[model samples]
Target: MNSFFHDENVALYRKLIAENESNPSRDEDRHAMLLTLLAEETAKAKQLPRLPDAW
Candidate 1:
């Protein structure tokens, strides 16, 4: 694998933290966003080709 392919996931982690926030004041919105993000990630993963064991 190349280093370029392992770019930092700063945006992804930030979104995950924001979605997982439990301030009670935004529970509904947060849960909805979480579900949307989960679906998006799943779709993206499904579209990628499988890698060999060496990876």
Candidate 2:
């Protein structure tokens, strides 16, 4: 289970994605949303307990 994602956030992203899918104009919206989600995941990962193995 992903602790970082809440109900509200999921709903909001779903709405955004649905909107972009319904209308194929202005391709930046999907890219921007994806980047935002990635950044959010990075932020959440930073808060986790550190381990020996790393990049």
Candidate 3:
């Protein structure tokens, strides 16, 4: 994979850690935003196509 893809994934991972550490549940808005982000990520993962010839 290219550096850009790897960078983006790393950035997303950092953001998730930050979000969790910040205790978003204390604030309704932040909690909702986190949920939205998680839902979007889940949807994107589900949309990825499977390879034609996997081992």
CA-lDDT, candidates in order? 0.55, 0.61, 0.60
Off by more than 4 A, model 3:
1-25, 51-55
Q: Given candidate 1, what's the lDDT at residue 47?
A: 63
Report lDDT (Cα) of residue 53, candidate 2.
Answer: 50
Model 2 — which ten-residue stretch has the worst lDDT? 1-10
The C-alpha RMSD of each candidate to the native structure, in angstroms, is 5.2, 7.4, 5.5
Summed backbone clashes in each candidate are 0, 0, 0
Candidate 1 structure quality by residue, lDDT tens digits, 1-55: 2322222233464466565674546667666766676566555555656666675
- List model 2 lDDT by residue over 1-55, tens digit each: 2434543455566677667667757488565876587567666756766545554
Q: List the residue pairs that clash in candidate 1.
A: none
Higher-lDDT candidate among 1 and 3?
3
Best by TM-score: 1
Model 1: lDDT equals 0.55
TM-score of each: 0.49, 0.46, 0.46
